[model samples]
Target: MKNEGMERLGKDELSAKDSYYINVMRGLSILRVVLVHLGLSWFYPPYSQYIGIFLPVLFFVSGAVSYYSFLRAQSVGEYLVKRLVLVLVPFYVFAALVLLITVVFYPERFPSGIGVVSWLLVWPNFSDVFFPLNQVWFINCLVVMILISGPIFFITKKRPWLLWGVIIFSLVVSLLNVPFPLYAAVSEYSFFSRLRWGHQAWQVLVLLGLFICGSVHYRYLAGQSAKKYALISIVFLIFALMGYFYSDLGFELKEHAKQRSLYYLFLSFFAIYFLLALERPILRILARMRSLEWLLLYTNRYAYSVYLSHTLVLFYVEQWLGLTDLGGQPFLALVRMFLVLVITLAVAKPLGDLSRTLAHTVRAKLLNGIIGGVRT
Candidate 1:
């Protein structure tokens, strides 16, 4: 809570209004992440299908938030250091712990064993490989977005037109069916291809588009008409859904073709601008719930941990509860959802806290002995 020595562009923290939006969006992102994990192999139509549509918005919000931090930081070094220490450090440690657990306990998933240190070094594996805590793709993507936001901010600073052009181009790419090859050695039958982007060019372009939107938000949108921005968000959403649905009409178009660049762009704008647009109403509703605030706050803080661990937890929980069989019974799907939601929150949050505390204690002792001679 005490963000000392963390100076930003104009303020040390977001405005109360801005904080409200951030909190709401953060909560929404976490909710979707949970839903996706639970919905896996569940209902196939409509609601069961929107998980893909829902998760990308989190990335857009991430780009927006990271861009805000980038502008506020005194220097690039400060930005990178703070983000990595606070965000990336916890992510990597928790992910590694997950890998350790799966290899030790659920060896069926890790055929190569722990000796493949090189695999851990690569991030795409965070999504493709299900060792222990497997839902870490968002963190990896956000890390990539944060690292590049600076150059994006600088490049699009003076040229607003250029930024829009890049966004539109990325949107075009999203509408087209183009596979970005990341690995050639993997068997074409391998599941790894699903996780790897065939085109880094489009990925970076889309990230920049989101970054620009986030930057423009700070520079201009904040003080402007919330209604207008909300309308923009709505219009973008309509186009996104159109792209998503229409991609199947052509051979060159693929289902969910709106993913890479266009999806992040549209969803980022939709979540952010609409959030600002609905600031007053949302806060009033959320403020009424006193006890739930802690729950929301807890999720916001340890969301990365929850995201990392939920899949493995679900793996065990499904087996124990026999909920996967309920996929045939639509009503039972709801019951399973409720059960998974409760059990996951109960298990993941505390486990995440314990993991962080242990890591912190170990680091503290190691540093104290080196710096203070055991407090003589």
Candidate 2:
């Protein structure tokens, strides 16, 4: 009912200063995601290489926000309940809607009934059920990351060294190749199995490390002096540039596609840190454009909805107009991306409102039930 989009950083959770730059960054990231998915990178090859930072930045932001929320939570149970509703409900609602549409209009692409059941259960089958729901992987992964953060936060509240150890361990695991036997065993079980310890397992580890990095940055470094910020920015820029060149040279060939190790992770970190370091300058530039400021703010506010729904809209647009053949045409690509943006926002706005309302309603009911049971 409140119409806020997925409540990325509410007033209660973040101060205005803290939330503003985050909103801007998130807005930019979601826009980049939509553009990249629309094949924007095809027209400009370097775009793909540069945009790798977006997802990592998103995870970092999620980590910071999740940490703050965890701090304010009364109990782990309550926090987990709230998080599950907020994160998963929108995903399920929109995913089901997309599935139904695909079944009705493009049934050939829809998965079998068993696959549908598996998808509804959030079971990861190696099937087409996840194709349309591709981008929602971030949501799926975020839910797991946030769940892990709770225990990590509690355990490492006093022992900062333990937190670093966990991060280091995650990094080490991400860098190592999973044994062939282990990979083969996990590949056969189910989606959950794959998600837990298959190819995606490395992704989870890397994300966990980035999440911790974000949490640590927010806790300790968010309010540093301008000089310190500039120094940090310069250092991050140096590494980011180096990583960019390294990626260009193809030294880390899989870095572009798989992004499994510390090499790519450092690239992401450099980008995020540079963004943080330049926040003041970015805000200053944004201040000069009143209309652009409002636009970015609105985009930031509705980012979750946009991210969730944009791919579906893009798919429909491509199918309807046969845009696949227009790849090399820069003008057409931009036009197609613009149209996708327009249509995605149109659909996402209402769905996002519904998701927010449903999540809030569910939370209220659950909290009331818990309170009533205790009172009784």
Candidate 3:
């Protein structure tokens, strides 16, 4: 029993090498996310088509990390509190700051009087308006996924086949084009219709499936031999290429749009496998470049902040500098993307540092106060 307990602990703990590779992948994903939001329509083909792979990879990494986090947490309440502070607090802080800027400068972009109050009281919907806060839908969805992850982890652990079963069921539901009244009702209420339980069922289901896939990959595949991973990776890469070039089946499935088509699901799986296979070789090359390695690590550390804040920076850049006019020109688009990335990193890094400090201080104070009260 003691040996088994030790083995379990070993399995749950991620090695430094594995962690480093995952962080690099996260940095790459965040970069792709910024590019996608930059409104570079011409950038989507050939190279950017590969960017679609990043979302599933991100979801997978999140699942793996969340599972480890769950194991370390003393209780579900503690796990939730940490997630709320780490994820939601930064999101709300950044969101409110963006909303304030819009209300003051771009008043027309934001809703008026009672509508503003209502939107704040409920969740801000990304679909309703062209607000900087729209990008935060990812964070909102993540929060929802984390809330339910404990049950998911248990189910996946006890009945691995059940996880695949759920995935198939979700895929079938997506194909059926099932109508949801609750989705329609809430969608009318706010742009954040995806946050409505009934509206985003298929999306959440697919994400959960992806999340499970990530957990399983980290647990099982991460330790495999290079030749084995390479072989698997090649197979998935071929399938992904075939889907992208030959068929539009998965092209319609976009997470941001809350559409999880069957083709997109397969595409995401293939992309993930290809990425995992490349991790070892990529890390070896990155290790040789000390400066570039550090940069990626730093970016990954503050990726969430970068993700939340980049759109706002991009919006202002476009408004002030007229970057949108150069949209179709490839060179200008590359320049614009570079500028947005640099400016966003500058703003997001400082904001992330400040938010982390504030969150830590607040959490410490609250815990101390509670302990003092108990003593009293």
| Candidate achieving the largest lDDT | 2
Give each model's whole-structure lDDT: 0.57, 0.68, 0.65
Best by TM-score: 2
**Which stretches of candidate 1 lie above 4 Å from their native place?**
1-13, 40-44, 108-119, 122-134, 154-169, 175-204, 223-226, 241-254, 257-268, 354-376
User: By lDDT, is 2 or 3 better?
Assistant: 2
Candidate 1 C-alpha lDDT tens digits along 128-228: 35534445544654666667766655565456335566556556655453344322322232454454543333345444565455545544455456577
**On lDDT, who's better, 1 or 2?**
2
CA shift at 253, candidate 2, in angstroms?
Answer: 5.9
The alpha-carbon RMSD values of the candidates against the true structure, listed in the order shown, are: 6.8, 5.9, 5.0
The sequence of per-residue lDDT tens digits that candidate 3 reaches over residues 1-376 is: 2344344435767767778788998887787788778753335554455456557778888877887776666555555656556776566567667678767876777766654553543346454346455555566567778888766666565454455665566555544433443324433455544335445444565567777666666655566666676687677666555544443444433432355544565567776777777877788888798777776777788888888878777777787787787645778767778888889888877778878887787667755665576579
Model 3 clash pairs are 125-191, 125-192, 128-191, 250-264
TM-score for candidate 3, please give it. 0.79
- Which rank order by TM-score, best down to worst? 2, 3, 1
Q: Tell me the lDDT of model 3 at 243.
A: 43
